[model samples]
Target: MTDLISENLQNKTGLVIDGAMATELEKRGVDTNNDLWSATALIENPEAITAVHKSYFQAGADIAITNTYQANISEFMKMGMTKKEGQDLIIKAVKLANKARVDYFRLLHKEDRDVRAAHPLIAGSVGPYGAYLADGSEYRGDYQLSEKEYFDFHRSRMQLLDKAGVDLFAFETQPNFDETKALAHMLKLDFPDQHAWMSFSIKDPETLCDGTPLQQAIKYFNIFDQISAIGVNCTTLENIEPAIKNIRAVTKKPIVVYPNNGDIYNPETKTWKANRQAETFTDLTPKWLDAGAQLIGGAVEQHPKTYNK
Candidate 1:
């Protein structure tokens, strides 16, 4: 009984680079004079999605995430996709990732192709529930079914990931802890054989949203099984290393760091430019490896160069 995902997770730490936003950008073709939303462009041409994954694989990434994060059914509803239609889109997205995995394996380990037979694992990404029934300010408001809404959302998508044969299932950019925890449990229940990873978004102050200390989050998350790793994502590059250090101080579990490129603001373009210097990001890679970081990679706006550098 060989567990491919857990085997990869047990090995020495490796990079888990980001690709969705870049895939969207490349597919959308950003114009300097005009800002664009990544969704519309990706829906039109998914090859942009495939190319991004291949680049990460070539850059030494050990895992690649499919472009199915925000492609969830609920999120798709916002973009006018029915539940069936969204599921179909995700199935197609995973297939594209599988194709990239085949190509990446060929490029990176051409010699080993005959031996390994498979490329790096493809992690199916489940994103935020995206249905904030209550206003942001109403954090305590009675948003009915808040827990069920999120859990059901993840469970629905997890089933699809299972059918797609994703090597791992990852829940990322979670804003709330209880909801994230629920999703984790659901994944474990559904796929006791595969691996699961959770990544929380950092508050502006670099803590969980409930003012819960970072150490508390680490302790709270320690109860689950099959959770190969945990870390911070979708935040500034500068904050990730320190945040991960704090996380490591509490748990012996593997830590993942996939911070967004950088904070961005657009005066005239009304865009958020979350790109960072690949060289500097690369410099921190060694330190992160030394800091006991078991996994590291980029989030939004991260290019293949970041990992390759």
Candidate 2:
């Protein structure tokens, strides 16, 4: 299997992943107040999803993550969609991002089109099972599931994403260590050709949301060759540097970090509160790179323009 991420990083300082998809879609006037969140656009306003992807690419992102983070089969089915309809929406998410990549390139100058860096990769966003609960269990990581249960919940969506041709999987914002271990095992056993970057939701610099030691969780996957990169996401800006340093201490793989804007999320109300003391991505990107992050981006409330240097 080709290490697509490594190929893209050969001569680059770092790969810039696109900013938040749910919040970006909300800015485009798509109502994301529902459980579907950004995936609601897949049915109500798909073009807005495509437009969001294009905007990120134009903002100079090296990777555009698909908006399937909350678009699992069970969630879509609960909305009165059939099983097949739910699967199609996941595939559509990938297509929209792929179209944005294609359309963005056509808008570039002919001379610039041939450059490797100008071509962006599409990462299929696989959010944690907690995202499907739509009650903010992702941040808590208190849910428990047997290994088979975890694999069964995730396998179909992964198959759909892989069949749709994503460059890689973004097993991101994961909180449970056992759940992630199940996913890693499933990827190596079932989808051997595909690779993914795993980013955890953490409680602090040293602990995962589920109470696992950050270094222990990261070190456990050192033997899984299918995991291409490892780090943290949807955490505080203050946590990025220490998390990256911790990750660097355990593995030589690329470090991917995309923390939330200074705001803090309240899952009960599905709202965010401003944190005046939160550091800006502009003020922190270089520090993250210096701390050994090879791939960087933003989480909630972070707009594409934030990456426009």
Candidate 3:
């Protein structure tokens, strides 16, 4: 397995991941009201995807997650594209991110580039199956699938991402315990040389959205060397610290946390409303690092300005 994440962590306090992709695309005047979300930009406004990735790198992010969070083959087929066309879009997502990385590095002064802690990484975003459902089932984790079904749903995208040359996978916003296990198993059996980080959608500080205890979930992946890091994401700022403590108590592996900008999501309406008591990343990043978060970032409603802090 590659020691990409571990090697980076050994030199820095924490690696900063890029902020939200879909929401950032929305700010650039892209239409994301459809089921495809940010992936729509892959076909219609690919240059915007590259610009977003470069913006994050400029904002000091150490990783740029590709815009494939909702770009699965099944969804593409539903949009009237053939299977080959859909798979091409998935590969295109990684190419766009890599272009941004190369373009960003080329613009940096040689002295500035040489002073970097580690090279910025491209994380192929493997969003949960609920993301394809596009109804916010990711936050509830109520879906069920047999072992073969889960494998069938995720395998093609993983293979495409791997073939496209992602530094690693970012299995972010996962909520179902069984689905996470299936993904971990798939990584071990099918993509033996690839490494990934698994970040969950939590119900509270103590449990996953599917009701598995946070400690139990963290422990389950402790033996999987391929899971480079384990933590939570797409959750509120308030939930991060306690969840990190729970995860750190169970594993010595790196912990990745990217909580949403404190806003309440109405899955039914697919809109966000302000949270009066929401905490800022400036106020919480130090606490999270102290509590054991090794990689930190913002989720939906966050932007380059948020990460620049």
Candidate 4:
């Protein structure tokens, strides 16, 4: 974890990343009914997106993930946007995170003595190929595409995200070993300077959704220099501990974990079946840290109530 932190995010100990950008946006009254989800806020209400980022920063998040989880050109074209317009929106997602970080620091650090607050890092979101499908495939992860095909799907958007100057990348909620390999290889070959973390959406503690063994996947991906950390996200809370312990047994690289609010997601319905096992992120943080997650936070439920102010 210490090795993965850039010079900007000075605290290497236990950095808190912000939670669901889309959920916070919906809380702020952004309409998120379409296939585009929160990315629509980037076009319809960008300030609300930035406000979500600011709220997380104010709430003590050390890193802010840009609102590009579902931002891609293929979907934009279906919505009647040109390729250029889609690319611009992707770039705008990163800009909003930067703007929010600036505003957060300026508003909170008006005096030099308040410089104790470290500038939060921006992580460009790279949701899996299933996210573009919008059929709950991100959690399923069986894209059935070849390696080259998966690489092709990710290349353009990654280049634009890098060009937009994000401090790092967050490959969140990935479900298959093949696509994970493809994306990791893409970063190694094409975007050598960029550092990214890959978090999978697992089916159980030991297995990925595609039925690959979790230990085998981490052992292979953890060696890549560009692939900074490996772990799980968008999964149930009960599944996180066993997954983290299994990951730690295989590799010493930083483990990053951001599970969902313990709800079951139905891809066909595109809705979450809430679970009673849900615990506040604060209550779960120590357990996750003790279990071996270096970076810890919430997703889908890291709402306005989680904020301090």
Candidate 1 residues lying further than 4 Å off, grouped into runs, are: 1-6, 9-13, 23-42, 78-80, 107-119, 131-145, 204-206, 265-270, 274-279, 299-309
> How many backbone clashes does every candidate have?
0, 0, 0, 0
Give lDDT tens digits, candidate 4, residues 65-176: 8899889989998999999999999999999999998887777645531332244678899998888888878877777899999988888889889899897889988898
Provide the overall lDDT of each model, using Cα atoms, as 2-decimal numbers.
0.63, 0.87, 0.87, 0.80
Q: Each model's RMSD to truth, in Å? A: 4.8, 2.2, 2.2, 3.2
What are the per-residue Cα lDDT tens digits for candidate 1 across 266-302? Answer: 4244245645443355567677777767667774333
lDDT winner, 1 or 4 = 4
What TM-score goes with each of the models? 0.79, 0.94, 0.95, 0.90
Lowest summed lDDT over 10 consecutive residues: which window, candidate 3? 300-309
Clash number for model 3? 0
Clashing pairs in 1: none
**Cα lDDT, model 2, residue 145:** 97
- Model 4's alpha-carbon lDDT is 0.80
Estimate, for each residue in 1-309, the C-alpha lDDT of model 3 and write its tens digit.
Answer: 566998777767788888888778888989887888889998899999999998888777788898998889999999899999999999999999999889888898977665554667899999999988999889999999987899999999999999999999999899999999999999999999999999999999999999999899999999999999999998888899999998999899999998888888776665678887987787788899889888888743333233222
Residue 43 lDDT, candidate 4, scale 0-100: 88
lDDT, residue 299, model 4: 54
What lDDT score is found at residue 140 in candidate 1?
22
Sorting all predicted structures by lDDT, with the top scorer first, yields 3, 2, 4, 1
